[model samples]
Target: MRYLLAGPDDYSLKQKLSEIKLSLGDTALLADATTLFEGARVKAAEFKLTVDALPFLTPCRLVIVTGLLSRFQPAGGQVNKASRLEEADTFSAAVRAAPPTTAIILIEPELNRRNPLFAGLADILEVHEFPVLDRSGLKAWIGSRVSLCGGAIAPGAINLLAQYVGADLWALSGEIEKLRLFAGSRPITEADVKTLVGYTGEASIFNLVDAVIECRLKPAVESLEALKAGGLPAGYALSMMSRQLRLIILYLDLKSRGEKEIEIRRRLGLTADFVWRKTAAQAARFSFSRAAVAYRRLLETDLAIKTGRMEESAAVDLLVAELASGAGLETRELS
Candidate 1:
């Protein structure tokens, strides 16, 4: 059977690939019969030879090719169309000629539907596209993941998890497993997620933001250290901080206009009660002017890091110190 698995959702794509591998007889024999080819480097003739080769010590063989379809993408029309068509046709013909005993799986992180190769094989092969899930779909996936791990979770916990983790399935799956082990006999709750799920980054970001708002240099530095130890890159940390500051500014502005909590939450797209409450409290503590100053500093640090004016680590450290010490905020009134 010929199969085409393509999408940005690598977690699901990997799971689907594993399922296919497990379906072929014994694990050891399957490994022996499997052949992997890097589509970008592998020639069509070589791929054909491998697919046509008989299985070794197994009834069926699994042939996996990754990034094959994407290589045929026109790439803004820079590639010569005639040559691309020739190569794509060659691959398509190879795919069509695979034996019934061999399962040819072509995997791509993303594939252009208009690519000649995909257009040629779309009708014959089993094509699966794994798009990133929306909020509702993400909640369903989280619940299913928890149940699969032999654990139960409260609806509030599920909502909070979806909000904190968003659509990253790899992180979501890891968090669910951690929560499952932590909860043990009891169902996972909102508190558990608040304590564990966001600790890796989100919760720490909140803590850092709180420290910055309160002008507590010690806790802000500690939060920075925690984030660094968690293996989060400095750039990503800065981006998250910027995002939180923007949210706080928006919240304060909206609340000043007499917007109710429910309407404000909807406007901010904060669905989880835990997130909404935490953000509302932070907004209350942080004045709009303070958030604006911090956001400007964040932008400056980002520019410095991006323009090679300063190292990412040093730039982030300087930004944290400046924000925590009220260096720039001292000139402006608090409210």
Candidate 2:
């Protein structure tokens, strides 16, 4: 059997891969019968050799290749075009001749249908494309996943979870498990979702960054406390804030260069449209000098936490206080 699983929904793709492995029977036997390769670097001859190898005390062998298909994708515009063409030819020939007892799985990002690699295999194997789910689909998926974990979620809580997490199943799946554990035997509530789901952390970290950048000292401290109360760890909160600052710095640089939002988003590899918009809005609030100072202070705080000079929780609070109060900035806007 040959399988091609391509998608942005990596969570679902991985789940499918796990299902395939589990279907192979005996977890202990998997190590023996399974072979893996980094497809981008692997030679077709080497892949064929593994695929031709007979199963060890099993009916079939499992082989997985990732990132290889991208080389053959038309829009990829991969370097070494001739090498990729030759590699695609090799793969096409080898896949057609693969042994019945070997199961080959190709995992790649979205590929063009016109690409010869996929067009050739379209009729020959099981090919599934997993795209990002829409809002309705995401909501249904969350409810189903909650039940799968032996927990029930209220509809209101479901809506709240969907609204906060968006359509990223990869993040939503993890958050669901956390909510399940936090809920225990009680039904999960909207309030519980707000408390335990990290949604508050996700939403408020941006506010905290804005408050700090704007020198709104009181709101910055309050935002940090609210995040901590919502079950976001000090280290996690600090890390998130640092990420926000870094994003702002990058956004400022890009805008200064007159780069458009779409180009900046592509450069940053940020798939979430709202995130890019939020970062842009935040970046607009700070001058380059202020953003750079905040970034430096963030690094100092991180180092202090690492060296054990300050506890993780206290370091985060102090970091917020200093940045909000403009301690490290020459401009030092006293609010």
The candidate maximizing lDDT is 1
> Can you list the residue pairs that collide in candidate 1?
none
Residue pairs with colliding backbones in model 2 are: none
- Model 1 worst lDDT window (10 residues): 71-80
Q: How much lDDT does each candidate structure score? A: 0.81, 0.77
Best by TM-score: 1
- Each model's TM-score, in the order given? 0.62, 0.60
Q: Give one digit per residue, the lDDT tens place, for model 2 in 4-116.
A: 99866666888998988887777678778888776656887897788888897887888888766765653323334466667777887788788888888988767566666
Q: How many backbone clashes does candidate 2 have?
A: 0
